[model samples]
Each structure stands twice: as structure tokens, then as C-alpha cells.
Target: MTRTLEWQVRVGLSEEDGTTRAEAVLDTGSEKLIGHGVARCNPQDVDVPVIGDELAASRAMKDVAAQLMKAADHELETVGAGPASGPVAPPYAWSDTTA
Candidate 1:
């Protein structure tokens, strides 16, 4: 069986030097961390470069993952009884419902 962990990413913006810079926030329940530095302001402020968006998002995700691992590995202690060692159930199965 496979288990899914939930996570969420939030984007935020701030104005600096007449241009809006983007930032990202990651929520993993146990830990919350702000990721990536704001993209450099554009010349016109209204026009945002494509490359910046990609870079900013990528950086944020990387940072979030790093933070999560650091917290999990703290003091060699396991959290929440540690990840399941054995598969709890088959990957996929179905029960008959037709009469």
C-alpha cells in the first residue's frame, strides 16, 4: 500500500523599489518554512520576466524539502512512530457491489 502525505505551497508578493517581488511559503503541518528570496524587481515593474517565476518557484520547493528533512532527522529521534515499515494493504483492490 502507498500512503500520501499532504503539503501546500503559498505564494506572496512584496513591493520593493517600485517592483513586486515574489516569495513562497510551505506548510507541512509539523513545520512551516519560508522559501526562496524574492525575484529581483523588473525595470517596468508591471512586466515580470518568465525566467524569474520559474526560478523563484523552484528555489522555494527546494528550500521547503530541506527544512522538512532537517526537522525529521533531529536528534536521531523518530517522529510519529516512524514511517510504516510494512505495506498495510495491497496497492489496489476492489469489492463487488453489483447484486
Candidate 2:
């Protein structure tokens, strides 16, 4: 069987106190989740707005991903399945899980 669907995500970024903050909203048709992230430049680091935006956005998405995983795990439990094990972490999210 094959199925297709769309999920909507909106991310916003703002700067304050030498830090950038990112807020993300995910709409999964049946539910909504919020994710947040922040980026701060060190005193010695070159202050770059784009870098800060990228870092904050990446972190916020990570937050949203955690929420998505938790929801899916809950659904699996609803059907008597066990919580997902092993790793699905960032920077290596595509690793094959088979042994």
C-alpha cells in the first residue's frame, strides 16, 4: 500500500540580547506542536546574522523532530508495539538500522 500526505511547518526568527531565537510550528493535520531554539555568538566570535539564523533554525527543527518522534512512538504503543529503540539522531539520521 502507498499513502501520501503533507505536513506544514512555519518557522520564525528574531534577534535579541545578542542572540537569535527561532520558533517553529508543525501542523500534522491532527495535531500541532511547537519547537524553540536559540543561538548566541560568543564574545570572541565574529557576529554573523546568517550563521545565527541557521543555527537557531536547525535547533528548532531538532526540537520539532523530537516531538514528532514522541507522537509516533505513542501511536505505536496504542497498538501494543514497543517504543522505538536504537538511534535516529541528527548528523547521521539516514544510517541503516538493519543488522
Candidate 3:
């Protein structure tokens, strides 16, 4: 069977008092999920607004990914398929030599 599905994700960001906050929302037609993240600049660190925005946004997206994985695991359990052993690893890992 050939099927087409569309999922939409929206991310919003705000900065205040040297802190950046991000919210990521995903809509899969039948369901909606939201994830939030915050980034704070240290007093001694340079005040780079863009860096904070990036960090907060990435963290929020990671939160959304975890939620999606949990949902999938639940669905598997419902179907009598055992829960996943653990969270799946990322496609690649950072290496000290590559940095």
C-alpha cells in the first residue's frame, strides 16, 4: 500500500534576562506534541544571543524527539510488542579527534 503522511513542526523562541527559551510543537494531524527548552548565559561568558537561541532551539527539538520515541514505544506495547530496550543511538557520535 502506498500512503502519504504529512507532519508539521513549529518552533518559537524568546530571549529575556540573558536567557533564551524555545518551544517546539509538532502536529501529526491526529495528535499534537509540545517540547520546551531554556538556555542561560553565564555572567562571565560573552553575551551572544544567537548562540543561546541555537542551544535552546536544539534542546527543544531533542525534547520533541524523546517524546516521539516514547509514543512509539507505547504503541508497540499496545500491539503486544515488547517495549524497546532503550533509546536509539544517534546516527553518529562526536569524537575528540574530530573536534
lDDT of 3 by residue, 50-91 (tens): 999999999999899889987987887789785457665453
- CA RMSD of all predictions: 10.5, 3.7, 4.6
Off by over 4 Å in 3: 84-99
**Candidate 3, run of 10 with poorest lDDT:** 82-91
Q: Write the per-residue lDDT of candidate 2 for residues 1-99, one digit (tens) a residue.
A: 999999999999999767999999999898899999999999799888999999999999999998888887778778878545675346436666776
Candidate 3 residue pairs in clash (backbone atoms < 3 Å): none
Clashing pairs in 2: none
Model number with the top TM-score: 3
For 30-65, candidate 1 gives per-residue lDDT tens digits of: 767887644565576565555566656666666766
Residue 43 of model 3, lDDT score: 92
Candidate 1 off by > 4 Å: 1-4, 13-20, 40-48, 75-99
lDDT of 1 at 89: 38
Overall lDDT per candidate, in order of appearance? 0.62, 0.88, 0.90
Query: Best-fitting candidate, measured by lDDT?
Result: 3
The deviation in Å at residue 84 for candidate 3 is 8.3
